[model samples]
Target: MKLLLLTALTMAAFAANSVLNRAAVGEAGMDALAFGVIRLASGAAALAVIVAWQRRGFAMGGVGRFVAVAGLLAYIFGFSVAYRGLDAGLGALLLFGVVQVTMFGGAVMAREAVPLARWVGAAVALAGLVWLLWPRGAVKMPVGGAVAMCIAGLGWGVYSLQGRLESDATQATAMNFMLAAPVAAVVWFLWGAEGAVTGVGLALAVVSGVITSGLGYALWYAILPTLGAARAGVAQLSVPVIAMAGGMVFLGEPVTGRFVGAAVLVIAGVLISMLGAQVWAGRVGFTKSSSGS
Candidate 1:
């Protein structure tokens, strides 16, 4: 139950990132690049303080750290770029679809044992996602924006895959932010729309960085090892649903019948992916024991 709650919280945090970006960059006229940079810097600062208290003194290292940092930077920048043109729902869909593919592919490459139920669940959830956010008539997609979201999805997938390798989730997340924050800030100052940064945007970015992103990511890292690859990928298929629901609740967006239906499908898929495998294993074990007896 605790793990379940933690996983749900992490997904909400992920969803909140989309909400914050929409509120700040999409509506408040905050430069996307500036929000991304501030988010990274603020997250880094918050985590650094935690690390200091732990007295870990920044021991992050090796190939895992390198991959983690690269993936983090890619996700942060690509997310900002994509959100500029894409609506919050569309952006979330693109980000998680690519993430599912990336992680499932990683599972294959690494020879991880993914159950059949998980694959079916992923497909069902993906179908629901497509149904919900596939865009209606006269909707024009900005190719660059869509492509940027794919990059963000890919980056997040890579980052998540590396998370299970970390010994200290907080310190590892801190180091990732610490290493990438400066680069993000540098790029922002060099070419970002400085004047476009608004006070509301700044506050949103800080909240996103310190709470949703910084702490959220730490919680995610802490849970990845326990989830395994296939389940983790399938689980994230819920983000778009969660994000859309967040919109209805916080942004006063009207929900439709379609939203309710799609939410059910997504939730059902998540349940099957997570629990079906365990049920199957249990049945198999029971049969083996009975035969032995």
Candidate 2:
């Protein structure tokens, strides 16, 4: 139960990230590069405070940390810059699609066994995404932004996989954020000056870092051990749907029939992917005894 709640919260965090980033870049007119840097700095600051207050042990040199940091840099920069031409909903859909596909493909390449249900789930989710964001009636997408978002998604997928190798989620995440912040800052210095960060943009970026990306990531790392990749991926399928809904409510973006349908399919895919474990647990004698007594 605790793990499930954390999983839900983690998904909400991801959803909040999409919504908040959109607000900053789309609504506030902040350059993606500047917003990305500010977001990273804000998240690092928030995590640093938590680490200090908690006195968490953080030793900073390892290959895993380096990989994670690089991946984080790619994701942060790619994510921010990608939005220069991509719409929020479409960008998110493309991002997650690449993330999921790459991660799943990586697992396959590693000789990991994937169950039939998971494949079905992946298919359903992919099809749903296509339906939701394939540009209706000759609406042209910005090719450069689309490519950037795909690369960003791949970076994020690699990051997620790297997270699986760490022993301490909080320690690893803090280190990644702290180290990656400098790299992000450098990129910002080189590119961010072009777009001045407005007040609203700063606030949105900070909120994204402090609340959704920072603490949310801490919560995610805490839950990763218990949830594993399949469950984690399943839970994250909720993010795009939530972001679409948030876009409707907060940004006054219209929700189409295709979006609704995609939501259903993606959610169904998640449930199906987890069905085996859920069913097996239910069938185990311990579940009944524990519940009854």
Candidate 3:
């Protein structure tokens, strides 16, 4: 139950990132690049403070650190830029769909021994995502935006994979943010200045970085060991549903039948994917006991 609560909170935090980004960039007229850089910097500062408070000197030394940094930058930049042209709903769908595919593929490659039921559930959830986000009438996609979101998704997938292997979630995340901050700063100097940042936008970006992103990512890493890759991939499908609900509340967006149906499907899929593993484990244990008896 504790784990479940933590997972739910983590998903909410992830969803909040989408909401905060949209609020900052879309409504506040913040530059996408500036928002990304500010977010990264603020997240770095927040994590650094936490790490210091914990008396943990930054010691996140691993071969995966560089890869994680690269993936993190890719996700931040691509996500911000993609939102410039893509609707938030459509962007979330595309981003998470690619993330699902990437993580699932990685899980298989790592020989994680995922169950059939999990795969089926993932498919169901993905189908629901498509149904909810699919544009009506002739679809006109911004090519650059689509490609950018795909890159963002792929980056996030890789970053999540790296996080699963971390021995110290906070320390590792803090170190990554610290290292990535410099890169983000360079990007900001080069391109991010194009977008103006209002006081409201900066505050939103800081909140997003510190609360939703920094602390949220640490919590996610802490839980990743319990979830494993396959289930984690499917579990994140809930983000879009949460984001849509957030939009309605925070952005005054309308709720639609399609979203309602998709939310049900997404929840059902996540439940099946997570519970199927327990059932499978139980069945295996029962088989062993029966044979011994």
Candidate 4:
């Protein structure tokens, strides 16, 4: 019972990131670059503190560390910038969709044995994304936001892939964030100077960094093993839905028929994919999967 509750809490925290990002970047007039930079720095600090409390030193040298840092930067900046033009729900969906595809593709490239259901599910999800991303479609999604979210998803996917090699998840993440912080600030200076950060914006960014992202991730890693791969993968399908509900309640975003249809298609597809491998393995839950939510 406690495990289930913790899992739910972790999922909510993950979804809250989208809501917080949208609120900060879209409504608070916070410059996206500033938000991204601050988030990275703050998250680094918070995670550093957590790691210290555990009496673990940071791992400063590894090729995987470098990749993790790079991927983290890309995801942070892309997510911040994308939210300036995207509703929380839409942004989450795009990010989620692309991330699944990227991870699935990576698995295929690595010669992982993918279940048939996963392949079909991936196809269905891709088709749904195509429907949503159609240039001249009924939904008329913003091209720039969609593209940025895709980049964010790809970055996150790569980060997750690299994370599998880590012996200590918290230490790896703390190190990655620490390494990425200064670089993120530089990037903000170069191209993220368009928007300004208000007090509310700063608060939102800090909470998102220190709470939703930093601590939330720690909590997730703590509970993830208990949930197992298949349950963990299936549980993430709820994030976009939670984000959508959060958008409606907190961000005043509307729910149109097109969005409803798209959501169903994408989420259903991912859920099927998650369960497919479990069923194929015959009683053993899926042990091969990526964790992005």
TM-scores across all candidates? Answer: 0.93, 0.88, 0.93, 0.76
The lowest-lDDT stretch of 10 consecutive residues in candidate 2 is 284-293
Q: Between prediction 2 and prediction 3, which has the larger TM-score?
A: 3
How accurate locally, in lDDT, is each candidate?
0.85, 0.76, 0.86, 0.72
- lDDT tens readout by residue for model 2, 1-293: 56666777788788888888778877888777887788888888888887877888777857878888888888887887787777765787788888887777766665555666667776776677667666656665699998989989888888877776777777777888889888888867776377868999999999988889888887777776555565566567678787878889999989788878888987777766656545544676445311110
Alpha-carbon RMSD of each model: 3.4, 3.8, 3.2, 4.8
Q: Number of backbone collisions per candidate, in order?
A: 0, 0, 0, 0
User: Better model by lDDT, 2 or 4?
Assistant: 2
Q: Which sequence of candidate numbers ranks them by TM-score, best first?
A: 3, 1, 2, 4
Cα lDDT tens digits, model 4, 174-201, are 8888899999887777874667889998
Model 3 lDDT per residue over 212-245, tens place: 9999999998998767788889989988889889
Residues 1-293 of candidate 1 have per-residue lDDT tens digits of 57668888999998898788778876898887888889999999999999999898898688889899999989988987887788656777788888998988888887777778888889888888878887777766789999999999999999999997887899999999999999887777787455488999999999999999999999999998877777789888888788778878987889999888888888888887877777776877754311110
Off by over 4 Å in 4: 1-11, 82-97, 124-150, 192-194, 219-238, 255-265, 280-293
Model 2 residue 262 CA deviation in Å: 2.0
Better of 1 and 3 by TM-score: 3
Stretches of candidate 3 above 4 Å error?
Answer: 280-293
Candidate 2 — which pairs collide?
Answer: none
The most accurate candidate by lDDT is: 3
Q: What ordering of candidates by lDDT runs from best to worst?
A: 3, 1, 2, 4
